[model samples]
Target chain A: MEKEIKHLKYFKVECFKGLESVELNDIAQFNIVLGDNNVGKTSVLEALLFDEHPFTLLRRFYSMMSFKGLSSNEAKDYYNSLEFFFSNEKDDKVITYTVSYNQLQKNEFQFSIVDTNGMTEENIDNLKNNTLVDLSQLPNTIVLIKLNGMTNFYTTDINLYRQKKSAEISYQPFIKSGLSYDNDLVQFFSSTVNNDLKLRKEFISNLHFLSDEIAEITIDSTTVPNNPILMVLFNNNKRPIPLFMMGNGTIRMVRLILEIMMCKDNRLMIDEIDDGLHFSKMKKAWGIVLEVAKKYNTQLFITTHNSECLKMFKEVLEDERFEKIQKDVMVYNLFKNSENKVLNVDYSFKEFENAIENNIEIRG
Target chain B: MPIKIQLFVEGKSDKKFISDYLDHLGLNDVEIIPLKGKGEVKNIPAPRLEKNQLQGVKNGVIIDADKDKEESLKELKKYANFNLFDEIFFFPNDRDPGALEVVLENCMSSTKKQDFEHCWFQYESCLDNFPQGFRGPFAKSKVYAYLESVSPVLHSKFQGIDKVDFKDSSNWDLNVSYLDPLKMFLTKL
Candidate 1:
């Protein structure tokens, strides 16, 4: 059975003094946030994962203290609470659930329960064993429950994935496509064939065929001799360059197409997917992203300002290719109100287009 | 000092047509400047004098009737309310500014008895083409087009023909564009 975040019935968000009691209700899975500049769209995203505080997860994705709306005191309290908020369960050896916020008062923060039976110790161990493990083997489902006293507020179960044993040799878990490893991946290919030459040629040829409208790409095995590497020439006399030398959009396309061909479980989160691309290019980008998402069972969360991004995504939804991806995708338009308060309005394609055409500020 | 008649136009084609037309009219003291879009309203030079100070500007202002003519007129009234200039003229066309090319095509076809193949081709043939990005057109084309089709009364008022030394050369060197009539209307303001 496919899993999806059906609806965010109600959400009570708090981070800074100004944004202490914002609420959102009746959220569709694919909701859009629309608003003018300086609205707290990014804040809401952070509020969900972190307890309105900066964490290692936040640091890895974006800079700390980059966003405003919180006082220095509140920011400190949010960081301090992470230690007291969650700890390992003693007897059951599972993570205990608790919800804490400024409004709840000291030690008065209450939480509801949600079971995580499918996430067994074995699966957790398998997930966190390798330093470079594929995120696919990680938890796919998140359970949320509403707190008893806090109306319209919910908390999700948090479980840490830890490895039980440690091998002396640093072994990277390489999920193969049953094809020969590219020379770059050959070191990690245990007992796999050393036929990198054959696979590399096929890969470049396949990429060339994919972009038939563009010139054919040639694979020169002698120069770099790396696995998953393609040297493509644009003109007859010019020096050939690696495919990576192309812009980030092209590189992203290359990686995504290769992953789709491989058909592996890879969840991709593309930040600013519209970077270095025009409106016309974005349609094809959306198509490629969806194609990869379907072929690899990958979940894609792309943040973009390009209207074409939404247009193409809506096309994917209407066509119903991986019809579920549409249900899985979300769009949020963040806007600042006349009061300088930030609000987010979630909308589908029709609502968004209508609002845009009519000059209606739809952010709530 | 020569009086600078700064004419802000909507686009390159309009600018070119207006500039050439004005130059032909012997308005050597006038200078035309094109503001490409409504967005450039902010950058249009404000009065060099302080608010509630100095005398009003002697220069004239002309703006297109714009897409939303009623709203544009209201805005122009507010714009002129500052008393920055003596006059502001709005020409509300039935269609977009690009329709000038079509208007020219229809006029030329009626007078010459031959349909012009392409607006771009005819425009290129008539006007001095600039580099890739320089925007301006043969200023006199719009007036020439208007004069060819408009009634004689409107023509005489808008296009006051000058005395000719030679036969057809009079019309050739003459200010054939409608800008003189536009300026004539502005001179009263």
Candidate 2:
């Protein structure tokens, strides 16, 4: 049988975050990354988002730093946050993330920090004395992005942090843990599924595992004028309740399903996919995810620390309903080697099934 | 400090047998893992050994020689090429070409051996009267018959071969020479 082609066939990361060096080959459509905490499961997801235009790359870089509670509107603080993105083991201060869409095409992005020693003593003293220094008048630290035989540089300016630009390249939605349900959900729903009845039906049917009472979902701007809140109409004909009022698991599942629905023919990366979900819901959750991913041809990359989640993944893949795409799954186990370098061990579908069935420890 | 040791066996029967033997040797810190079958001995240990590599666990495997010692060893070495196992020992003293049943047969008492031989001769004669020959595994059949002869009530009450306590003196002599290689392997571990 011929193998199914995936959007990302290979990936490699050198000097990014806590990962010293790591490479993942033969990437599958549905990949699960397992490792100990701080072993760089989230780093791999961050690297996948690196293959973007320079503007979007800068936005993503800031977004990642903000995720770590390092957000700042000042130019100096933004420059300080760049120190946390590189690996501590290397002294040269260069980071590279590479990805291959197919065997013949490869894209590599290299990032390096440039020092600005041209600031005069008087200018530095003025910046220190002032509450908000004008970025146009000061020498700033610049980040150079080189990709596809092109180079672009962005300075640590307030405007770079304030500009919100959508990605011009392929869209890959990354759903992290504790994601807030905000206007993005409203815009995504209203633009994509609101006018299409088939998609809305599919979304509601997939969410039935969370609760059958979720009869319909909509964005209500009248409840809080100018603030559109996602509301759910239950089957009991009661008043619509805001999505934030629902349980954490329900909100997480809703967000996940929405992304999966919007992520057709693209890739989606989810961290700690079983974060707020109960063990009993894993099987149905996996079933819905696999069905939607297969239907839309969207590749999936998910991470989990729960063994029950792995077990349910194996069970759902082995299910007779998913026999066709059973061979499209892979599990990557990451662990630090004897030399303290991060390494990954890939397991094919059969090998993963064997390990799970025989009670072997592959989660590291 | 003593090194932590982990031993992998083929099935529940092998696990029970080795667990008792290790206990007899007074080595209790060793962990015995029973895999699904012989094929899994090649498939299951790489990831686990890598996971525990930092802990400095001495990993090893105890498997049956089956029909050929060299063939089994060659196949295992191919799969276990990760340099994980500290040692790999085959059953029936590692040099022989048989399974746990061979060791059990060797441990039978000399006095009962004569009685069992006579019963075996009579059983073979009874089977010869039927033109179709007996087609079961010879060593396993002999071990089961020997267990039944030792105590039919105990044999009937136990569910499987793995549940039979090898600690009973009447079942087998644990001090036999056929088990010295396994004992030495455990001792070294």
lDDT tens digits by residue: candidate 1, B3-118: 44444445555555445545554566554555555444333434221111221224455566545545665676565323555445554233234233432333232323233234
- The deviation in Å at residue B143 for candidate 2 is 6.0
What shift in Å separates residue A153 of candidate 2 from its native position after superposition? Answer: 3.3
Docking category of candidate 2: acceptable
- Give lDDT tens digits, candidate 2, residues A91-200: 86778877788857778777777564765787455434542323454354666565753453434555654465432222337888767565677777776777789988
Q: How far off is residue A97 in model 1, in Å?
A: 11
The superposed Cα distance between candidate 2 and the true structure at residue B133, in angstroms, equals 13
Error of 2 at B175 (Å): 6.1
Docking class of 1: incorrect
- Candidate 1 lands at a TM-score of 0.35
TM, every model: 0.35, 0.77
Number of the top-ranking candidate, with lDDT as the measure: 2
